[model samples]
Target: MTLLTYRTQARWAVAVVNSKKATAEFYDVETNKRIPRTAWTADMKAFAAEKAANVPKPPFVFRLTIIGWIVVALLAAGFGVMTYETLKPTEQSAEQVAMEQTPVVGDMYFGRFEGAAEPDSLVAISDLGFGWFKIVKVEGDTYFVAKSTDMSKQHQPKEQLESAEFEEEGTPAKIVEQTGWQLTLEAIDESVTFYVTDKK
Candidate 1:
Protein backbone atom coordinates (compact mmCIF):
# COMPACT_ATOMS: atom_id res chain seq x y z
CA MET A 1 0.00 0.00 0.00
CA THR A 2 1.22 3.47 -0.96
CA LEU A 3 -0.01 6.87 0.31
CA LEU A 4 -1.28 9.29 -2.36
CA THR A 5 -2.43 12.95 -2.08
CA TYR A 6 -5.27 14.57 -4.07
CA ARG A 7 -7.66 17.56 -3.72
CA THR A 8 -11.27 16.82 -2.82
CA GLN A 9 -14.01 19.48 -2.93
CA ALA A 10 -12.49 21.73 -0.29
CA ARG A 11 -8.99 20.55 0.70
CA TRP A 12 -6.15 18.14 -0.06
CA ALA A 13 -6.23 14.74 1.66
CA VAL A 14 -4.01 11.72 1.90
CA ALA A 15 -5.44 8.33 0.89
CA VAL A 16 -4.10 4.80 0.86
CA VAL A 17 -3.89 3.19 -2.59
CA ASN A 18 -4.20 -0.59 -2.61
CA SER A 19 -2.62 -1.79 -5.84
CA LYS A 20 -5.19 -4.68 -5.73
CA LYS A 21 -8.21 -2.78 -7.23
CA ALA A 22 -8.16 -2.07 -10.97
CA THR A 23 -9.00 1.59 -10.26
CA ALA A 24 -7.55 3.79 -7.47
CA GLU A 25 -9.90 4.81 -4.52
CA PHE A 26 -9.83 8.45 -3.43
CA TYR A 27 -10.75 8.96 0.25
CA ASP A 28 -12.37 12.30 1.10
CA VAL A 29 -10.85 13.92 4.15
CA GLU A 30 -13.92 16.02 5.22
CA THR A 31 -16.94 13.93 4.02
CA ASN A 32 -15.07 10.62 4.20
CA LYS A 33 -16.57 9.59 0.81
CA ARG A 34 -14.43 7.11 -1.07
CA ILE A 35 -14.25 8.16 -4.74
CA PRO A 36 -12.65 6.23 -7.55
CA ARG A 37 -9.55 7.79 -9.04
CA THR A 38 -11.44 7.68 -12.40
CA ALA A 39 -13.62 10.58 -11.03
CA TRP A 40 -10.83 13.00 -12.03
CA THR A 41 -11.37 12.03 -15.70
CA ALA A 42 -11.19 14.46 -18.68
CA ASP A 43 -14.87 15.51 -18.22
CA MET A 44 -14.32 16.29 -14.52
CA LYS A 45 -11.17 18.21 -15.31
CA ALA A 46 -13.18 20.25 -17.85
CA PHE A 47 -15.91 21.00 -15.27
CA ALA A 48 -13.36 22.10 -12.69
CA ALA A 49 -11.73 24.31 -15.26
CA GLU A 50 -15.12 25.87 -16.09
CA LYS A 51 -15.85 26.54 -12.39
CA ALA A 52 -12.47 28.18 -11.94
CA ALA A 53 -13.12 30.32 -15.01
CA ASN A 54 -16.47 31.52 -13.62
CA VAL A 55 -15.17 32.40 -10.14
CA PRO A 56 -15.29 36.08 -9.38
CA LYS A 57 -11.99 37.90 -9.09
CA PRO A 58 -11.15 40.48 -6.45
CA PRO A 59 -12.22 44.07 -7.22
CA PHE A 60 -9.53 46.34 -8.63
CA VAL A 61 -8.17 49.10 -6.40
CA PHE A 62 -6.89 52.34 -7.96
CA ARG A 63 -3.98 53.95 -6.14
CA LEU A 64 -3.49 57.66 -6.77
CA THR A 65 0.07 58.88 -7.21
CA ILE A 66 1.41 62.06 -5.56
CA ILE A 67 0.79 64.13 -8.73
CA GLY A 68 -2.70 62.68 -9.16
CA TRP A 69 -3.63 63.63 -5.61
CA ILE A 70 -2.36 67.17 -6.12
CA VAL A 71 -4.44 67.52 -9.30
CA VAL A 72 -7.58 66.28 -7.54
CA ALA A 73 -7.07 68.70 -4.65
CA LEU A 74 -6.62 71.62 -7.04
CA LEU A 75 -9.80 70.71 -8.93
CA ALA A 76 -11.75 70.47 -5.66
CA ALA A 77 -10.48 73.90 -4.57
CA GLY A 78 -11.49 75.46 -7.90
CA PHE A 79 -14.99 73.99 -7.63
CA GLY A 80 -15.38 75.39 -4.11
CA VAL A 81 -14.34 78.88 -5.19
CA MET A 82 -16.79 78.85 -8.12
CA THR A 83 -19.65 77.76 -5.86
CA TYR A 84 -18.89 80.57 -3.39
CA GLU A 85 -18.84 83.18 -6.14
CA THR A 86 -22.15 81.95 -7.58
CA LEU A 87 -23.87 82.14 -4.17
CA LYS A 88 -22.40 85.49 -3.10
CA PRO A 89 -24.88 88.37 -2.64
CA THR A 90 -24.84 91.42 -4.88
CA GLU A 91 -22.97 94.53 -3.72
CA GLN A 92 -25.73 97.03 -4.65
CA SER A 93 -28.03 98.32 -1.88
CA ALA A 94 -31.86 98.46 -2.00
CA GLU A 95 -31.72 102.24 -2.34
CA GLN A 96 -29.35 101.95 -5.26
CA VAL A 97 -31.64 99.47 -7.00
CA ALA A 98 -34.66 101.76 -6.56
CA MET A 99 -32.73 104.77 -7.74
CA GLU A 100 -31.73 102.96 -10.92
CA GLN A 101 -35.33 101.97 -11.60
CA THR A 102 -36.70 105.54 -11.26
CA PRO A 103 -36.53 108.10 -14.06
CA VAL A 104 -34.49 111.27 -14.07
CA VAL A 105 -36.07 114.79 -13.87
CA GLY A 106 -35.03 115.80 -17.37
CA ASP A 107 -36.75 112.74 -18.82
CA MET A 108 -39.93 113.81 -20.67
CA TYR A 109 -43.29 112.49 -19.57
CA PHE A 110 -46.32 112.33 -21.86
CA GLY A 111 -48.82 113.91 -19.51
CA ARG A 112 -50.67 117.24 -19.16
CA PHE A 113 -50.48 119.66 -16.23
CA GLU A 114 -53.50 120.46 -14.01
CA GLY A 115 -54.68 123.53 -16.03
CA ALA A 116 -53.20 122.67 -19.45
CA ALA A 117 -56.53 120.85 -20.32
CA GLU A 118 -54.74 118.83 -23.01
CA PRO A 119 -54.11 115.08 -22.71
CA ASP A 120 -51.40 115.09 -25.41
CA SER A 121 -49.15 117.61 -23.69
CA LEU A 122 -45.51 116.59 -23.14
CA VAL A 123 -43.92 118.06 -20.01
CA ALA A 124 -40.66 117.97 -18.02
CA ILE A 125 -39.01 119.80 -15.14
CA SER A 126 -36.43 121.19 -17.57
CA ASP A 127 -36.67 122.01 -21.28
CA LEU A 128 -35.79 118.80 -23.15
CA GLY A 129 -37.55 119.35 -26.51
CA PHE A 130 -38.99 122.30 -28.45
CA GLY A 131 -42.75 121.61 -27.96
CA TRP A 132 -43.08 120.67 -24.26
CA PHE A 133 -44.05 122.32 -20.94
CA LYS A 134 -40.82 123.05 -19.07
CA ILE A 135 -40.74 123.83 -15.38
CA VAL A 136 -38.09 126.59 -15.26
CA LYS A 137 -37.78 126.54 -11.48
CA VAL A 138 -38.71 124.31 -8.54
CA GLU A 139 -38.72 125.23 -4.82
CA GLY A 140 -39.40 122.51 -2.26
CA ASP A 141 -42.05 120.27 -3.85
CA THR A 142 -43.35 123.20 -5.94
CA TYR A 143 -42.94 123.53 -9.70
CA PHE A 144 -42.89 126.97 -11.39
CA VAL A 145 -43.91 127.06 -15.06
CA ALA A 146 -46.28 128.85 -17.42
CA LYS A 147 -49.67 127.97 -18.95
CA SER A 148 -49.76 125.90 -22.14
CA THR A 149 -49.73 127.99 -25.29
CA ASP A 150 -49.49 127.31 -29.06
CA MET A 151 -45.71 126.92 -28.77
CA SER A 152 -43.94 124.75 -26.13
CA LYS A 153 -42.22 127.82 -24.60
CA GLN A 154 -45.61 129.48 -24.29
CA HIS A 155 -46.92 126.44 -22.28
CA GLN A 156 -45.05 127.39 -19.05
CA PRO A 157 -45.92 131.06 -19.26
CA LYS A 158 -45.23 132.15 -15.68
CA GLU A 159 -47.60 129.50 -14.22
CA GLN A 160 -46.46 127.88 -11.00
CA LEU A 161 -47.60 124.53 -9.45
CA GLU A 162 -46.62 124.28 -5.79
CA SER A 163 -46.83 121.74 -2.97
CA ALA A 164 -45.04 121.28 0.37
CA GLU A 165 -44.59 117.46 -0.14
CA PHE A 166 -45.27 114.76 -2.76
CA GLU A 167 -45.97 111.03 -2.82
CA GLU A 168 -43.10 108.56 -3.29
CA GLU A 169 -42.35 104.81 -3.34
CA GLY A 170 -39.23 102.73 -2.74
CA THR A 171 -36.06 104.81 -2.29
CA PRO A 172 -36.52 108.44 -3.35
CA ALA A 173 -34.18 109.22 -6.24
CA LYS A 174 -33.01 112.64 -7.27
CA ILE A 175 -34.93 113.23 -10.52
CA VAL A 176 -33.48 116.70 -10.99
CA GLU A 177 -30.86 118.93 -9.41
CA GLN A 178 -31.26 118.76 -5.62
CA THR A 179 -32.21 122.39 -5.69
CA GLY A 180 -34.11 123.64 -2.65
CA TRP A 181 -37.14 121.94 -4.24
CA GLN A 182 -38.61 118.78 -2.73
CA LEU A 183 -39.08 117.12 -6.12
CA THR A 184 -41.22 114.11 -5.16
CA LEU A 185 -41.51 111.35 -7.75
CA GLU A 186 -43.91 108.44 -7.83
CA ALA A 187 -43.95 105.53 -10.28
CA ILE A 188 -47.36 104.25 -11.34
CA ASP A 189 -47.15 101.19 -13.51
CA GLU A 190 -45.62 102.24 -16.85
CA SER A 191 -46.09 106.00 -16.11
CA VAL A 192 -44.88 108.38 -13.40
CA THR A 193 -47.16 110.96 -11.69
CA PHE A 194 -45.59 114.35 -10.88
CA TYR A 195 -47.19 116.64 -8.28
CA VAL A 196 -46.14 120.21 -7.61
CA THR A 197 -47.59 122.87 -5.36
CA ASP A 198 -46.71 126.56 -4.92
CA LYS A 199 -43.57 126.92 -2.77
CA LYS A 200 -44.67 127.19 0.88
Candidate 2:
Protein backbone atom coordinates (compact mmCIF):
# COMPACT_ATOMS: atom_id res chain seq x y z
CA MET A 1 0.00 0.00 0.00
CA THR A 2 1.12 3.53 -0.80
CA LEU A 3 1.30 5.78 2.30
CA LEU A 4 0.86 9.54 1.99
CA THR A 5 2.31 11.25 5.14
CA TYR A 6 1.80 14.74 6.50
CA ARG A 7 4.02 16.35 9.21
CA THR A 8 4.58 19.71 10.87
CA GLN A 9 7.32 21.46 12.88
CA ALA A 10 5.72 20.33 16.21
CA ARG A 11 6.25 16.66 15.11
CA TRP A 12 2.55 15.69 14.60
CA ALA A 13 2.23 13.23 11.67
CA VAL A 14 -0.73 11.51 9.96
CA ALA A 15 -1.17 8.97 7.16
CA VAL A 16 -3.91 8.99 4.44
CA VAL A 17 -4.72 5.70 2.73
CA ASN A 18 -7.48 3.89 0.81
CA SER A 19 -10.71 4.68 2.78
CA LYS A 20 -13.52 3.02 0.82
CA LYS A 21 -13.36 4.93 -2.49
CA ALA A 22 -13.49 8.78 -2.24
CA THR A 23 -15.37 8.95 1.06
CA ALA A 24 -14.16 11.72 3.40
CA GLU A 25 -11.29 10.68 5.67
CA PHE A 26 -9.59 12.51 8.54
CA TYR A 27 -6.08 12.71 9.93
CA ASP A 28 -4.47 14.10 13.10
CA VAL A 29 -1.80 16.19 11.37
CA GLU A 30 -0.83 19.53 12.87
CA THR A 31 0.10 21.01 9.48
CA ASN A 32 0.18 20.31 5.69
CA LYS A 33 -3.67 20.85 5.58
CA ARG A 34 -5.60 17.55 5.98
CA ILE A 35 -9.29 17.19 6.87
CA PRO A 36 -9.88 16.25 10.50
CA ARG A 37 -11.48 12.79 11.21
CA THR A 38 -15.19 12.89 11.95
CA ALA A 39 -18.21 10.56 11.99
CA TRP A 40 -20.82 10.61 9.09
CA THR A 41 -23.68 11.94 11.27
CA ALA A 42 -25.06 14.17 8.48
CA ASP A 43 -25.47 11.25 6.03
CA MET A 44 -27.33 9.20 8.64
CA LYS A 45 -29.65 12.15 9.36
CA ALA A 46 -30.34 12.66 5.61
CA PHE A 47 -31.15 8.97 5.17
CA ALA A 48 -33.63 9.05 8.06
CA ALA A 49 -35.29 12.21 6.66
CA GLU A 50 -35.66 10.63 3.20
CA LYS A 51 -37.24 7.48 4.69
CA ALA A 52 -39.72 9.60 6.72
CA ALA A 53 -40.68 11.63 3.61
CA ASN A 54 -41.42 8.46 1.61
CA VAL A 55 -44.04 7.22 4.11
CA PRO A 56 -47.70 7.48 2.97
CA LYS A 57 -50.12 9.91 4.68
CA PRO A 58 -53.75 9.33 5.61
CA PRO A 59 -56.69 9.86 3.18
CA PHE A 60 -54.78 7.94 0.55
CA VAL A 61 -55.93 5.64 -2.30
CA PHE A 62 -57.51 3.25 0.21
CA ARG A 63 -59.90 5.98 1.37
CA LEU A 64 -61.10 6.53 -2.18
CA THR A 65 -61.78 2.80 -2.52
CA ILE A 66 -63.92 2.84 0.61
CA ILE A 67 -65.96 5.79 -0.67
CA GLY A 68 -66.61 4.00 -3.94
CA TRP A 69 -67.94 0.97 -2.10
CA ILE A 70 -70.29 3.17 -0.07
CA VAL A 71 -71.73 4.83 -3.14
CA VAL A 72 -72.38 1.48 -4.77
CA ALA A 73 -74.17 0.23 -1.66
CA LEU A 74 -76.44 3.26 -1.58
CA LEU A 75 -77.35 2.86 -5.24
CA ALA A 76 -78.20 -0.80 -4.72
CA ALA A 77 -80.45 0.04 -1.77
CA GLY A 78 -82.36 2.75 -3.68
CA PHE A 79 -82.85 0.45 -6.65
CA GLY A 80 -84.37 -2.20 -4.39
CA VAL A 81 -87.00 0.15 -2.97
CA MET A 82 -88.05 1.58 -6.32
CA THR A 83 -88.17 -1.86 -7.87
CA TYR A 84 -90.36 -3.10 -5.04
CA GLU A 85 -92.81 -0.24 -5.53
CA THR A 86 -92.94 -0.71 -9.28
CA LEU A 87 -93.55 -4.45 -9.13
CA LYS A 88 -95.98 -4.74 -6.21
CA PRO A 89 -99.58 -5.65 -7.15
CA THR A 90 -102.20 -3.00 -6.37
CA GLU A 91 -105.50 -4.92 -6.30
CA GLN A 92 -108.32 -5.62 -3.85
CA SER A 93 -107.57 -7.72 -0.78
CA ALA A 94 -108.73 -11.33 -0.29
CA GLU A 95 -111.31 -10.33 2.31
CA GLN A 96 -112.92 -7.90 -0.16
CA VAL A 97 -113.24 -10.65 -2.79
CA ALA A 98 -114.93 -12.94 -0.25
CA MET A 99 -117.47 -10.23 0.67
CA GLU A 100 -118.36 -9.59 -2.98
CA GLN A 101 -119.09 -13.29 -3.55
CA THR A 102 -122.05 -13.10 -1.15
CA PRO A 103 -125.11 -11.28 -2.56
CA VAL A 104 -127.14 -8.92 -0.36
CA VAL A 105 -129.82 -7.37 -2.58
CA GLY A 106 -131.27 -10.16 -4.76
CA ASP A 107 -128.98 -9.87 -7.81
CA MET A 108 -129.36 -6.06 -8.00
CA TYR A 109 -126.33 -3.92 -8.91
CA PHE A 110 -125.21 -1.83 -5.92
CA GLY A 111 -122.27 0.51 -6.68
CA ARG A 112 -121.16 1.47 -3.19
CA PHE A 113 -122.83 1.50 0.24
CA GLU A 114 -120.00 1.86 2.73
CA GLY A 115 -118.72 -1.16 4.72
CA ALA A 116 -121.38 -3.34 3.00
CA ALA A 117 -124.29 -2.80 0.65
CA GLU A 118 -127.81 -2.42 1.99
CA PRO A 119 -129.54 -5.75 2.72
CA ASP A 120 -132.86 -4.56 1.20
CA SER A 121 -133.58 -3.31 -2.30
CA LEU A 122 -134.91 0.28 -2.27
CA VAL A 123 -136.48 0.22 -5.73
CA ALA A 124 -137.97 -2.18 -8.28
CA ILE A 125 -135.24 -3.99 -10.26
CA SER A 126 -136.65 -2.61 -13.51
CA ASP A 127 -136.45 1.04 -12.26
CA LEU A 128 -132.69 1.04 -11.39
CA GLY A 129 -130.41 3.47 -13.32
CA PHE A 130 -128.23 0.54 -14.41
CA GLY A 131 -131.06 -0.80 -16.61
CA TRP A 132 -132.16 0.82 -19.87
CA PHE A 133 -134.51 3.81 -19.21
CA LYS A 134 -133.96 3.27 -15.44
CA ILE A 135 -132.01 5.27 -12.86
CA VAL A 136 -130.25 3.91 -9.72
CA LYS A 137 -129.53 5.83 -6.45
CA VAL A 138 -126.03 6.95 -5.46
CA GLU A 139 -124.55 8.09 -2.14
CA GLY A 140 -122.52 11.19 -3.30
CA ASP A 141 -120.70 12.66 -6.30
CA THR A 142 -116.95 12.76 -7.10
CA TYR A 143 -116.92 16.55 -7.62
CA PHE A 144 -117.36 17.04 -3.85
CA VAL A 145 -115.49 13.88 -2.90
CA ALA A 146 -112.07 15.61 -3.29
CA LYS A 147 -110.20 12.85 -5.11
CA SER A 148 -106.47 12.66 -4.26
CA THR A 149 -103.67 10.18 -3.56
CA ASP A 150 -102.70 11.57 -0.18
CA MET A 151 -105.77 11.78 2.05
CA SER A 152 -104.80 14.72 4.29
CA LYS A 153 -104.59 17.07 1.32
CA GLN A 154 -108.24 16.35 0.40
CA HIS A 155 -111.09 14.15 1.62
CA GLN A 156 -114.28 12.76 -0.01
CA PRO A 157 -117.26 15.09 0.31
CA LYS A 158 -119.72 14.10 3.00
CA GLU A 159 -122.75 16.30 3.75
CA GLN A 160 -124.33 19.38 2.20
CA LEU A 161 -127.76 20.92 2.94
CA GLU A 162 -128.02 23.46 0.12
CA SER A 163 -126.37 21.27 -2.54
CA ALA A 164 -128.47 19.36 -5.07
CA GLU A 165 -128.54 15.54 -5.09
CA PHE A 166 -126.68 14.22 -8.13
CA GLU A 167 -124.19 11.64 -9.51
CA GLU A 168 -121.11 12.56 -11.61
CA GLU A 169 -121.43 16.35 -11.90
CA GLY A 170 -123.15 17.80 -15.00
CA THR A 171 -122.30 14.80 -17.20
CA PRO A 172 -125.50 15.09 -19.38
CA ALA A 173 -126.94 11.84 -17.90
CA LYS A 174 -130.75 12.08 -18.06
CA ILE A 175 -132.95 11.27 -15.07
CA VAL A 176 -136.41 9.83 -15.88
CA GLU A 177 -139.32 9.21 -13.43
CA GLN A 178 -141.71 6.34 -14.19
CA THR A 179 -143.75 3.68 -12.37
CA GLY A 180 -143.33 5.40 -8.97
CA TRP A 181 -139.47 5.48 -9.38
CA GLN A 182 -136.72 7.88 -10.52
CA LEU A 183 -133.52 7.35 -12.59
CA THR A 184 -130.35 9.35 -11.96
CA LEU A 185 -126.71 9.14 -13.06
CA GLU A 186 -124.82 6.56 -11.01
CA ALA A 187 -121.21 7.40 -10.00
CA ILE A 188 -118.20 5.56 -8.57
CA ASP A 189 -115.46 7.00 -6.38
CA GLU A 190 -111.97 5.93 -5.31
CA SER A 191 -112.23 3.71 -2.29
CA VAL A 192 -111.52 0.13 -1.20
CA THR A 193 -115.15 -0.83 -1.74
CA PHE A 194 -115.28 0.99 -5.08
CA TYR A 195 -112.25 -0.94 -6.33
CA VAL A 196 -114.00 -4.21 -5.56
CA THR A 197 -116.64 -3.48 -8.21
CA ASP A 198 -113.95 -2.66 -10.81
CA LYS A 199 -112.39 -6.10 -10.42
CA LYS A 200 -115.77 -7.80 -11.02
Candidate 3:
Protein backbone atom coordinates (compact mmCIF):
# COMPACT_ATOMS: atom_id res chain seq x y z
CA MET A 1 0.00 0.00 0.00
CA THR A 2 1.11 3.56 -0.80
CA LEU A 3 0.44 6.74 1.23
CA LEU A 4 -0.33 10.13 -0.35
CA THR A 5 -0.58 13.69 1.06
CA TYR A 6 -2.37 16.73 -0.35
CA ARG A 7 -2.74 20.44 0.60
CA THR A 8 -6.02 22.44 0.61
CA GLN A 9 -6.93 26.15 0.17
CA ALA A 10 -7.72 26.25 3.95
CA ARG A 11 -3.87 26.11 4.29
CA TRP A 12 -4.15 24.23 7.57
CA ALA A 13 -6.02 21.18 6.22
CA VAL A 14 -4.17 18.02 5.13
CA ALA A 15 -5.44 15.00 3.19
CA VAL A 16 -3.95 11.52 3.65
CA VAL A 17 -4.86 8.44 1.62
CA ASN A 18 -3.86 4.79 1.56
CA SER A 19 -4.26 2.33 -1.21
CA LYS A 20 -6.65 0.21 0.85
CA LYS A 21 -9.00 3.10 1.86
CA ALA A 22 -8.72 6.90 1.44
CA THR A 23 -9.13 9.01 4.63
CA ALA A 24 -8.51 12.70 5.32
CA GLU A 25 -7.59 14.61 8.51
CA PHE A 26 -7.60 18.40 8.95
CA TYR A 27 -5.20 20.33 11.23
CA ASP A 28 -4.80 23.88 12.46
CA VAL A 29 -1.29 24.84 11.23
CA GLU A 30 -0.73 27.53 13.89
CA THR A 31 -1.44 25.09 16.75
CA ASN A 32 -0.55 21.87 14.90
CA LYS A 33 -3.75 20.38 16.39
CA ARG A 34 -6.33 18.21 14.72
CA ILE A 35 -9.51 19.97 13.51
CA PRO A 36 -12.72 18.18 12.67
CA ARG A 37 -13.95 18.66 9.14
CA THR A 38 -17.32 19.89 10.45
CA ALA A 39 -15.58 22.69 12.45
CA TRP A 40 -13.73 24.12 9.36
CA THR A 41 -16.35 26.65 8.21
CA ALA A 42 -16.23 29.12 5.31
CA ASP A 43 -15.58 32.05 7.72
CA MET A 44 -12.60 30.26 9.28
CA LYS A 45 -11.23 29.50 5.77
CA ALA A 46 -11.56 33.20 4.78
CA PHE A 47 -9.93 34.42 8.07
CA ALA A 48 -6.99 32.07 7.56
CA ALA A 49 -6.48 33.34 3.98
CA GLU A 50 -6.64 36.99 5.15
CA LYS A 51 -4.21 36.40 8.02
CA ALA A 52 -1.64 34.69 5.80
CA ALA A 53 -1.80 37.56 3.28
CA ASN A 54 -2.12 40.66 5.46
CA VAL A 55 -0.50 39.98 8.87
CA PRO A 56 2.88 41.56 9.67
CA LYS A 57 5.91 39.33 10.05
CA PRO A 58 6.82 38.15 13.61
CA PRO A 59 10.04 40.24 13.78
CA PHE A 60 8.21 43.50 12.95
CA VAL A 61 5.55 42.79 15.57
CA PHE A 62 8.28 42.05 18.15
CA ARG A 63 10.02 45.35 17.32
CA LEU A 64 6.75 47.27 17.74
CA THR A 65 6.22 45.64 21.14
CA ILE A 66 9.73 46.62 22.26
CA ILE A 67 9.22 50.21 21.14
CA GLY A 68 5.93 50.39 23.05
CA TRP A 69 7.62 49.21 26.26
CA ILE A 70 10.39 51.77 25.82
CA VAL A 71 7.85 54.55 25.43
CA VAL A 72 6.05 53.42 28.59
CA ALA A 73 9.29 53.28 30.55
CA LEU A 74 10.28 56.79 29.44
CA LEU A 75 6.88 58.15 30.49
CA ALA A 76 7.20 56.50 33.89
CA ALA A 77 10.65 58.04 34.43
CA GLY A 78 9.40 61.50 33.47
CA PHE A 79 6.50 61.23 35.90
CA GLY A 80 8.86 60.08 38.65
CA VAL A 81 11.09 63.13 38.19
CA MET A 82 8.09 65.49 38.24
CA THR A 83 6.74 63.84 41.40
CA TYR A 84 10.11 64.14 43.14
CA GLU A 85 10.38 67.82 42.26
CA THR A 86 6.85 68.51 43.49
CA LEU A 87 7.19 66.55 46.75
CA LYS A 88 10.78 67.39 47.74
CA PRO A 89 11.27 70.00 50.45
CA THR A 90 12.38 73.46 49.35
CA GLU A 91 15.59 74.55 51.10
CA GLN A 92 16.76 78.15 51.54
CA SER A 93 20.48 78.94 51.19
CA ALA A 94 22.37 80.37 54.18
CA GLU A 95 22.96 83.62 52.29
CA GLN A 96 19.24 83.97 51.59
CA VAL A 97 18.38 83.38 55.26
CA ALA A 98 20.98 85.93 56.35
CA MET A 99 19.72 88.46 53.81
CA GLU A 100 16.17 88.06 55.11
CA GLN A 101 17.27 88.40 58.76
CA THR A 102 19.54 91.36 58.12
CA PRO A 103 18.13 94.87 58.46
CA VAL A 104 17.07 96.82 55.37
CA VAL A 105 15.84 100.35 54.67
CA GLY A 106 12.38 101.08 56.15
CA ASP A 107 12.82 98.22 58.65
CA MET A 108 11.91 98.80 62.31
CA TYR A 109 13.75 97.14 65.24
CA PHE A 110 12.12 96.77 68.65
CA GLY A 111 13.83 96.09 71.99
CA ARG A 112 12.65 96.13 75.61
CA PHE A 113 13.66 99.11 77.83
CA GLU A 114 14.67 98.00 81.33
CA GLY A 115 13.51 100.98 83.48
CA ALA A 116 11.20 102.75 81.03
CA ALA A 117 7.47 103.36 81.69
CA GLU A 118 6.60 100.65 79.20
CA PRO A 119 8.74 97.51 79.12
CA ASP A 120 8.41 96.93 75.34
CA SER A 121 9.55 100.21 73.72
CA LEU A 122 10.93 100.86 70.25
CA VAL A 123 14.65 101.38 70.94
CA ALA A 124 17.79 101.55 68.87
CA ILE A 125 20.71 99.16 69.19
CA SER A 126 21.74 99.00 72.90
CA ASP A 127 25.29 100.29 72.25
CA LEU A 128 23.80 103.25 70.31
CA GLY A 129 22.03 104.46 73.47
CA PHE A 130 18.30 104.00 74.32
CA GLY A 131 16.00 105.86 71.87
CA TRP A 132 13.52 105.16 69.08
CA PHE A 133 15.31 104.62 65.75
CA LYS A 134 14.64 103.26 62.23
CA ILE A 135 17.02 102.09 59.57
CA VAL A 136 17.33 104.83 56.93
CA LYS A 137 19.86 103.20 54.60
CA VAL A 138 22.23 100.26 54.38
CA GLU A 139 25.74 100.42 52.93
CA GLY A 140 27.76 97.19 52.86
CA ASP A 141 28.39 96.25 56.52
CA THR A 142 27.26 99.69 57.76
CA TYR A 143 23.64 100.32 58.87
CA PHE A 144 22.70 104.01 58.93
CA VAL A 145 20.16 104.27 61.79
CA ALA A 146 18.36 107.56 62.32
CA LYS A 147 16.58 108.62 65.52
CA SER A 148 12.80 108.87 65.30
CA THR A 149 10.15 110.43 67.57
CA ASP A 150 9.66 108.39 70.72
CA MET A 151 7.06 105.62 70.66
CA SER A 152 6.95 104.43 74.27
CA LYS A 153 3.86 102.29 73.93
CA GLN A 154 3.59 98.67 75.16
CA HIS A 155 2.63 97.35 71.69
CA GLN A 156 4.81 97.76 68.61
CA PRO A 157 3.75 100.70 66.42
CA LYS A 158 3.84 98.73 63.18
CA GLU A 159 1.32 100.93 61.35
CA GLN A 160 3.10 104.19 62.33
CA LEU A 161 6.53 102.70 61.66
CA GLU A 162 5.58 101.63 58.09
CA SER A 163 3.78 104.94 57.28
CA ALA A 164 5.61 107.21 54.79
CA GLU A 165 5.10 110.21 57.17
CA PHE A 166 7.26 108.41 59.75
CA GLU A 167 10.42 108.78 57.58
CA GLU A 168 12.87 111.60 58.40
CA GLU A 169 15.20 113.40 55.94
CA GLY A 170 18.47 114.32 57.62
CA THR A 171 21.94 112.98 58.36
CA PRO A 172 21.90 109.61 60.18
CA ALA A 173 22.54 110.13 63.90
CA LYS A 174 24.47 106.82 64.22
CA ILE A 175 26.27 104.50 61.77
CA VAL A 176 26.65 100.98 63.11
CA GLU A 177 29.19 98.96 61.16
CA GLN A 178 30.21 95.42 62.15
CA THR A 179 31.61 92.26 60.68
CA GLY A 180 29.83 88.93 60.99
CA TRP A 181 31.90 88.02 64.05
CA GLN A 182 31.39 91.46 65.61
CA LEU A 183 27.65 91.23 65.02
CA THR A 184 27.59 87.85 66.74
CA LEU A 185 29.49 89.27 69.72
CA GLU A 186 27.12 92.26 69.85
CA ALA A 187 24.16 89.90 69.85
CA ILE A 188 25.66 88.06 72.82
CA ASP A 189 26.43 91.27 74.76
CA GLU A 190 22.98 92.78 74.13
CA SER A 191 20.70 92.61 77.18
CA VAL A 192 17.49 92.69 75.09
CA THR A 193 17.13 90.87 71.81
CA PHE A 194 16.32 93.13 68.87
CA TYR A 195 13.71 91.81 66.40
CA VAL A 196 12.63 93.25 63.06
CA THR A 197 8.95 94.22 63.10
CA ASP A 198 8.41 95.62 59.58
CA LYS A 199 10.40 94.95 56.44
CA LYS A 200 10.29 97.12 53.38
Number of backbone collisions per candidate, in order? 15, 5, 0
For each candidate in the order shown, give its overall lDDT on alpha carbons.
0.38, 0.31, 0.44
Name the weakest run of 10 consecutive residues (lDDT summed) in model 2: 126-135
lDDT winner, 2 or 3: 3
Instruction: Count residue pairs with overlapping backbones in model 2.
Output: 5
**TM-score of every candidate:** 0.28, 0.22, 0.26
Candidate with best TM-score? 1
- The 10 consecutive residues of candidate 1 with the worst lDDT sum are 10-19
Could you give me the TM-score of model 2 versus the true structure?
0.22
Give the residue spans of candidate 1 off by over 4 A. Answer: 1-59, 93-200
- Model 3: residues with Cα > 4 Å off, grouped in runs: 1-87, 90-133, 160-193
Comparing 1 with 3 on TM-score, the higher-scoring candidate is 1
